[model samples]
Target: MYTPPAFREDDTAVLHALMRAARLCNFVTATAEGLMATPLPLFLDEGEGEFGTLYGHLARANRQWQAPVLGEAMAIFMGPDAYVTPSWYAAKREHGKVVPTWNYVVVQASGPVEFFDDPARLREVVTRLTDLHERPRVEAWAVSDAPEAFVAAQLRGIVGLRMPVTRLMGKRKMSQNRSAEDRAGVAAGLRQGERASDHVVAELVAEEGAS
Candidate 1:
């Protein structure tokens, strides 16, 4: 969250797009006991508030939900990330002054957290979540695909969460601080990596360098 001006992303639309693209986020809250966190797949209601509202669910057994939050809760969304070796930096060849680094994109949303257990509300949240993920699959699944009694019983084991985002912080560190030549080398190096995320990061690096 400590972002330099070169990496800061303050555009609301860009921040929301990055948030939407992230399939999962770390939901964290400060409690009297300690910091509690959960990895959750949350949906964003972009029109809900000034910064949009986040919706998700937590397991009924997850103690994080039961803990009293001392302050605003936070959701950390991670986007494309990759390791950048100094070997990829032109500066390394020009003068051995380069060091290894990492390039990544992240968005952190924080606000008051609301937990609910009403069956109807939980049902709606579950359905919306299911539809959002399933929409990309060929054979999409639905909550109605299961038995009514079974679905009802499953919903009982979880709780719904709502967070009207009050603050949004976004950072896009795609080798933006590097020289154009160094950044190009980074993009080339990432494109050669085996991980799919590496390829994604490559495109971002190339775009940043071009800009």
Candidate 2:
């Protein structure tokens, strides 16, 4: 991530918040063959280590888990993002020097990757993941809702992952580099757009500008 000082985010709390809010993450690892990546939903255990420990699972047949990692594995989490048009910049009218850019929030966690096939560990991971995502629903489901035999069989088809985070990098580019007037224009323009994510970015831009 080539982040300028204005866009760089180094606060651990903010970075962890972004990771928790992200719906999914891209898990990447460098291998002797090449680079392999998988889209996964991972949980962070904040109290487990200095940074945190990441937990997730991958399909047993996914070759990504079999590859030998070169050094460290990376998990990329993305937050709200939106396109910013030149028309939203006050500088465009001043001297026609404005260009289009994007506003987004992202975080990357890197650490040694470990894969396991222990049934007990897999069961715990599955239960925790299920509970985390289902908590907000009216009729929340749980691993115990399914028959033990069936759940055991299902767990056999997957492998568990654990990565104790050794490094964390975060970036939040919400028109922070723009002048106040230009940022206000961007917030206004995005708030009028149709996408829900655009509206989120708009609010973030407005909040940052106000600060």
Candidate 3:
């Protein structure tokens, strides 16, 4: 998260929006043995804490949950990114001093991590997570859609997590360090990229309009 002033994303609302849009996150923790990470689908409870709380789950057998990491958990959320070529910089033509770079958005959240295995809490967490991802679908599914015994058995194999986020670091590098003309060139180049992520970067550049 080495964000220069021109590329910093300090707005809480913007950070939360990026987190919500990022369906998957990398959850990392420190253990006596070593560092461990898991890619997980997480949901945010913005009203529950000063910054917010993260909710996710992992298999019961996953050693990551067994380790004591009450206050040393971090979740990384990555948004759209694009490669910036020197050709996209106006300075390249004037002085040929421009080099390639990357423009992207990311958020890192760290806080105390708590693990819960209680059946009731696990059930609630699972349902909430499912609803969050399924709400947009025509035939959304629910936890209760399965039989009681089946779902209960499934829950037994996993554990729920709650991380009360204490710090939030966000970075949005959208050609802010470039000259206005260079930034515009980068934006225009990204707008026509075949990758969907590049288009996203283009939109972010347009929104910021920073140089």
Total clashing residue pairs per candidate?
0, 0, 0
Candidate models: Cα lDDT each: 0.95, 0.96, 0.91
lDDT of 2 by residue, 1-211 (tens): 7989999999988999999999699999999989999999999999988889999999999999998899999999999999999998999999999889999999999999999999999999999999999999999999999999999999999999999999999999999899999999999999999999999999999999889
Mind giving the per-residue lDDT tens digits that candidate 1 earns over 1-211? 6999999999999999999899899999999999999999999999999999999899999999999999899999999899999999889999999899999999999999999999999999999999999999999999999999999999999999999999999999998888999999999999999999999999999998777
Best-to-worst order by TM-score is: 2, 1, 3
The segments of candidate 1 whose C-alpha lies over 4 angstroms from its true place after superposition are: none
lDDT of 2: 0.96
- The TM-score values for the models, in the order shown, are 0.98, 0.99, 0.96
RMSD of each: 0.8, 0.6, 1.4
**Clash pairs for candidate 1:** none
**Which numbered prediction scores highest in TM-score against the true structure?**
2
Where is the poorest 10-residue window by lDDT in model 1?
202-211
Ranking by lDDT: 2, 1, 3
Which portions of model 3 miss their true places by more than 4 Å? Answer: none
Q: Give a tens-digit lDDT track for model 3, residues 83-155.
A: 9889878898999988899988899999989999999999999999999999999999988899999999999
Candidate closer to the true structure by lDDT (higher is better), 2 or 3 = 2
Error at 189, model 1, angstroms: 1.1
